[model samples]
Target: MAGFWLGPRAAMRGYRLFGYDSIGSTSSEAMASARRGDAGDVWFAALQQTEGRGRRGRVWESPSGNLAASLLIVHEGDAASVATLGFVAGIALQEALSGNLPASALRIGVDGADGLTGQGHAARLALKWPNDVIADGGKLAGILLEAQGLPDGRMAIVIGFGVNIVAAPTGLPYPATCLHALGTPVSAEAVFAALADAWVDAFELWAGGRGVADVLARWRRHAAGLGSEVAISHDGQVVRGIFETIDEFGRLIVRDGARGTIAITAGDVHFGATATSGRT
Candidate 1:
């Protein structure tokens, strides 16, 4: 297959693009590049990944024809604030996919979730809290962010994402769906093109984390499972409560019935009656 190419939209944004037919993981490449004193703002896309991983080191199946990409961002900021980029990535991915598929084809309903209603195209694409894109109540895509300190006193964040375009995984913890299965078949290259453009817009709006308030506001508009019962598991403990809202620093606010509003920094969130599924 031909290598992936960035169109004018992505090129105009000053993103250094790299494409591969197969690799261990795009995020791994970005991290290695950062360690070698390379300047950031680079995007790595691969047709297949041999050793991709998800949150908590779960295996990420990246068969040929899926979208496995990662962006290397070198930012000078406190670790707490830089992590908010995950929210920015979620919004960018949503917009990228929504731009390619029709509005009617993107809407997914979550059982027993209020505030799930949306208007127009924005309503169809929903953000599942911190790092997921939900369609038809199933997972369409996921975002994984990893950061490491550089020798030059800077931090490099590798924003990795895997989107099921032509196929979805089977026998997973939760239901998985792909773009083609959802009636919006598209090429991995086309999706990457849109994603690059959207990433530029989202990064600019983030303004070095100064504009996170705006990012969070926009994210809430596409939020899924808001005002619904949910469970979050972290480090072997599970917290179940009402899915409240995202806090100022982008932490998930869960209104535990007994614990009262708990601010969750990292965990796998499960919604509705399936709160015990332990799926992220």
Candidate 2:
């Protein structure tokens, strides 16, 4: 693992950087840092992750060559900003890949099959709502957020990101693609550095008290499922609807049967049969 402790430098800049060579999960490590009263923006980056996970406690493949890191942020922000964690991570990942694949317009895509690659050199990477990054219609990266309160009544939000940089694991539930398969090769350090810079910018923007509508607008431009039939599962009820737009609080607006339109605040959203579906 690599250590890039900017210490007072980052602390003065409002972030404390802590890196590890190997760990069970960067999110877990960042949580540990939070428990020790390491407040503010604490970033834990690892060279290799032994036990990385995503939503629903599913295993997240984190080989040595991929990027695994988590950021612990103690911020005074509303729940809306906190809930839009995926957009922040998605914007960051998009920018990070842009630096490497300058010629290719790196847009987000949904995953269609596990271990599937785009035909020829054209890579179709899509962004799924709430925080799944898909490539060639399969999962490429996932963002998991965990937040807790501090002794001072502040909130510490941990943003964990696992990206498939070098290779995509074979035999997954859905189709998975990697940067290597897309013909873009990058070192782990380079990817992490780019992501860190991008994430810092994204966090600053979100923390500035801007409405989530702007973020939603940006997401829609790169979004893959607008106007598409989808299934939103929340609170043990699965509602099938046409994806209309994103509401003010970042909830997905779905036009369901006779219900007119329903807003989904939290759940696993999957594209309906018209396109393809994947686990949340």
Best by lDDT: 1
TM-score of each prediction: 0.92, 0.82
lDDT of 2 by residue, 1-280 (tens): 4844442333556665667778899898788777788855767888779999888788888887787879888777766577787687777776666566534544444422111123334335556777877665666777898888778877788889888888788986456767777777776666777777777766566655574566666665556567777877766777787888777777788887698998887777677452334344
Clashing pairs in model 1, backbone N/Cα/C closer than 3 A: 108-136
Candidate 1 wrongly placed segments (more than 4 Å): 105-122, 276-280
- The C-alpha lDDT values of all candidates are 0.84, 0.70
Scored by TM-score, the top model is 1
Candidate 2 stretches greater than 4 Å from native: 3-14, 102-123, 234-236, 272-280
TM-score of structure candidate 2: 0.82
Q: Show the lowest summed lDDT stretch of 10 residues, model 1.
A: 112-121
How many collisions per candidate?
1, 12
